[model samples]
Target: MSTLRIYISNQCPSCATAIHRVHFVRRLRPEQSVELINLDHQDTVRPSYVFGTPTYCLGNQIIFLGNPSEGELLSKLDQPLSSVKQIT
Candidate 1:
């Protein structure tokens, strides 16, 4: 499955929003795989230090920050995997 990591804390509103949005997308597009990584958990935080409540990483490359957006997620569905980050 393609990696879609979401770093979030359960207590955060943004994280909750992101989770719901991700679930919506998952239901709509069953073909895609979405993984929710809880930032509060020690295991997840070590691999990815999420300063903010909600952060999205598409295959180890962060594509979005802050609150989640359905439109933004859909827009990048077709983008090729980048080398984590793009300087531009």
Candidate 2:
């Protein structure tokens, strides 16, 4: 199963909004697994490239750098896996 991993930080001003949007997306796409990783926690392990809050990752790729609009996010999520671009 494919998963959507959302990385967030407590100190980021936009983190709250990004989290809310993710939750909303979850409700709309039950088939897709959503994981929230809080970078503020010392034990959290993430890719070194994920340096910003509100980063969205699908599989091993970073899909979005910040908060994305609901329509845009849904469009990306709904696409066939082969069509989704790989961003390391």
Candidate 3:
């Protein structure tokens, strides 16, 4: 299984919504591992890795940007790697 990482900026309004959505989804599925990275305080040197706030990275590769719907997030997680190309 791939890991999910959400890159966020605390100061961003959209990031706040994205954060809530991600947590809600995580709470529904406790078995899934989801990590949040706050760009404002984290030592993130490569801004390119996180092109913008509220970006979702799966297994070190960016998969989604901005706020994603619950269905979309779940679909991506359920998909096999062979079906979709990883951004990395």
Quick one: best TM-score, which candidate? Answer: 2
Ranking the candidates on TM-score from highest down gives: 2, 3, 1
On lDDT, the leading prediction is 2
Error of 3 at 25 (Å): 2.3
Separately for all candidates shown, the number of backbone clashes (residues 3 or more apart, or on different chains) is: 0, 0, 0
Q: Model 1 scores what on Cα lDDT?
A: 0.72
lDDT for residue 78 in candidate 3, whole number 0-100: 82
Q: After superposition, how far is residue 35 of candidate 3 from its true place, in Å?
A: 0.3
| Full-model lDDT, candidate 2 | 0.85
The 10-residue segment with the lowest total lDDT in model 3 = 42-51
Which lDDT tens digits does candidate 1 get at residues 1-88?
4677777887887777888878887898788888887867767543534567687877666778876568768767666665347423
lDDT of each: 0.72, 0.85, 0.78
Q: Rank candidates, lDDT, best first.
A: 2, 3, 1
Steric clash pairs (candidate 2): none
Better of 2 and 3 by lDDT: 2
**Per-residue lDDT for 1-88 in model 3, tens only?**
7768888886788887777867886888788788888888857654466778888877767778887888888888888856655565
In model 1, the Cα lDDT at residue 77 comes to 64
